[model samples]
Target: MSLNFDPQWLSRYPAQEPVGGAVSSCVFCGIACGDVEAHVLAETADTLCFLDHLPATYGHVLVVPKQHFQDLLDIPEESFQHVMATAKQVANALRDSCGASGINLVHATGQAAHQTVFHFHVHVVPRYDGDSIVVFPRLADPTRKHEVAQRLRTALNAPQPPKTEAESSQA
Candidate 1:
């Protein structure tokens, strides 16, 4: 596919820690340590599902392997199966809980594709006719991309507070 580029937005990103480096440099590794408002749907030795912060809609969620893997090819076949199965379960829950018509599953790999966090996550964004969520358009302006990454970084770095009974189900 032909790609379009925008330079202005790309200029705003802060220099981030490298992906798949020493354990301390891993961003996803830190996610569980804080109370960053993740609505964790399920967790297992192999995988976890949690609500997406930048939801395409209310029920947008993400599924990932518990073990950090930077890209799709890096995931072992069994772990991939477990992650996908959990994603499917979450999508069904979204339909029941949020009245979603359908879901969109997505993943990005490497810096060029904007997989900023460097963790293999499958996004299960719910779809409705009037909802803002849609598939990729492939025109990356630096402004919005930078803004999104900044927002996510802020959320990821936020403090961990204690959880309530209602909030405990997802965790």
Candidate 2:
């Protein structure tokens, strides 16, 4: 291998899928299971949408596919479209609920992608002038990182899918 680094060289690599491990366990999975308090915005056969437990903004929400895939590559194309379509629905709902100017839909696939939770989820943050939350993320303590990672890993190990057909309808 050449010692020289090149950005273009990295592009040659094919994308990778999420590997299930400890990080798959997250409290968010509990929220997704209705074990915790979350303002559910939408749910489809392939996806479910809810407010972010830790709000990025007043109306921050999340859209997750029903299947427990950690990252994008693990998601089937149909599930991907369903998740994104649900995200769009949540964006509209957030606009109506919060009366915001706009919304931002986001996702992080890998650790490098800032995917704190291993389960695949899309963020829908409502944007408005003078909002309390900032766009930037705060840094975390490195010492506690491993412990926190372990906790999340345990939580997401096994996830229950949406319980009923009614639960899979519009928000």
Best candidate per lDDT, number?
Answer: 1
Tens digit per residue, CA lDDT, model 1, 128-161 = 8787543665566776988899999999999989
For model 2, what is the error of residue 163's alpha carbon versus the real structure, in angstroms, after optimal superposition?
33
lDDT of each: 0.73, 0.71
**TM agreement with the true structure for every prediction:** 0.66, 0.60
Per-model clash counts, in order, read 4, 8
- Compared with the true structure, the alpha-carbon lDDT of candidate 1 equals 0.73
The runs of at least 3 residues in candidate 1 whose Cα sits more than 4 Å from the true structure, single-residue gaps closed, are 1-17, 33-37, 138-171
